[model samples]
Target: MKKFNWLLMVCLSVGFALKAQDNSMKKLREETAGKIKNAEKDTTGRLWKRGGNFGLMFNQGSLTNWAAGGDKLSLSLLATFNGFANYKKGRHNWDNNVDLAYGYVNTTSLGTRKSDDRIDMTSKYGYEIGKNWYLSGLFNLRTQFSEGYLYPSDTTREFVSKFFAPAYIILSPGIDFKPNDEFSLFMSPFTGRWVVVMDDTLSAKGSYGVDTGKHVKSEFGAYISATWNKEIMKNVTYKTKLELFSNYKHNPGNIDIFWTNIVAMKVNKWLSANVSLDMIYDDDVRVFENKETGVMGPRLQIKEVIGIGLTAKF
Candidate 1:
């Protein structure tokens, strides 16, 4: 009878231990689930409270009749998406945006009627690092397609050799400083690739041709931009931006292109207007009198454009 009693006692102890372990596991699972649920709730709450805006724009402009008397009507569509996380009551936090723009232009009086289509896409990632400093990086890609006649002044009147090309792919890593909530300044120094594709006749000239596959050239450049946001009325705001860029070619003797400056203004977050001035200073041009006949000097060209567009935000 004692042996049977001992066996019963052992079995009861094992059962009790198993029951306790099961209960402990259930409690742990419940705690973990609660934590996960709370985390998700917090994230959703933050996302709902953050402010975001989207916009689109279209514009048209032209220059005086100088060479081809060409007039251009350009239509642009832009979309911007931004998000902010960790917003404090009086402090700035992490913010980022993605910008996309599509543009189409129809040109009249340039030999044959032509159209140019362009797409510009940029991804900007930024984070506030300190009281007045921010770190940011941008990836930018621009492609242009143009179909028209080549060299209208040429005696040969063949008009079917133009090709489309990738205009630019730029990677900019930079920093920003915001002195106040209303104004910010940014700068980036970078090296990028600028490609220009041309027809077989132009490529055969050796001055503009693709070496192996496609036409590609490396360039070094820097850009500086400033933005200001001001609230003029209860629900109205004005934004302005100034940007400048400089490009240096590998061979300094070649022409150097510079976008002197660009000024843009936005009113009530809807209508935006801009003007740009660009110039190419060619150092390789020869200005001398012919040995037999008297000639002239070097010629300089300047290009300017003014644009106005409308935007919608959601």
Candidate 2:
């Protein structure tokens, strides 16, 4: 009888321990599920998110008695602003972006002159049609904020462009493939492009595809654009956009390309470094000269800029 009682006690203890362990596992599973659900809810709570960064950079130098040959009392200044507004809800998504930059430089030898100027804006609207695909429309505009000049000599300057003088507008109805938040591809078989040279002098010269004395030139084209924004590593972010267009009304074989890229690195709060690259090629816009031939013709244009200074994020 004693042996039987001892065996029964052992069996009861084992059953109690097993039951306790099963209850603990069930509780753990419930807590984990609750956390996951809350996280998802929090992520989808906001329908619109807007943010951007602005930067101001400058450099100054003074030389009273210097051995090397360089400018005295040189000063440079640049200001930049970039922002985006994005909205995502059930089946609709809209994105709007703007970028503006202007800069100037002055020296003892060279008078104050504009170093850089830019204005670009884009708006995209999409309605979900399939997995990772959407029916979309895009509107884009590009121009300059101030007058642009080309200098053949230190004393002689020629007018090149100004606000709305060589402006470009692109409107397209397209299909957008968005694999994720950071990448998108847009393609349109039928696109409309307008080139405007509002300035009388530039218009009279038939600049930027506008007919002589005409203020605007219209073209039908096929357009493709790819955009990507990514954080390649910690504290480093890169963004790029590539655009291609072939004018069906003009030379379908000669394609126009526009590409821009930006890389940003954060050193600390309110301090950062930025690198920007922009390239453009247009068959109708012929102003660049071939140094070897001394003939004016269409050529690839590239500009690269690097800056390090104060940054503000919003």
lDDT per residue for candidate 1 within 1-314, as digits (tens), equals 99999999999999999999999999999999999999999877764344444434444456765586546543333333323232332333443333333333344543233322334444545567787877866555554444434353534443432343434556667887877756767778763545454445533432222453445645667756566657665554555445544556444344333223444556656775544454544332233235566663333536454556554444
Residue-level lDDT tens digits of model 2 in 120-239: 999999999999999999999999999998899999999989999999899999999998999999999999999999999999999898999999999998999999999999999999
lDDT (0 to 1) per candidate: 0.51, 0.93
TM-score of each: 0.45, 0.85
Off by over 4 Å in 1: 1-117, 145-166, 179-184, 193-214, 227-311
What's the residue-level lDDT of 132 in candidate 1?
81
lDDT winner: 2
C-alpha lDDT of residue 125 in model 1:
52
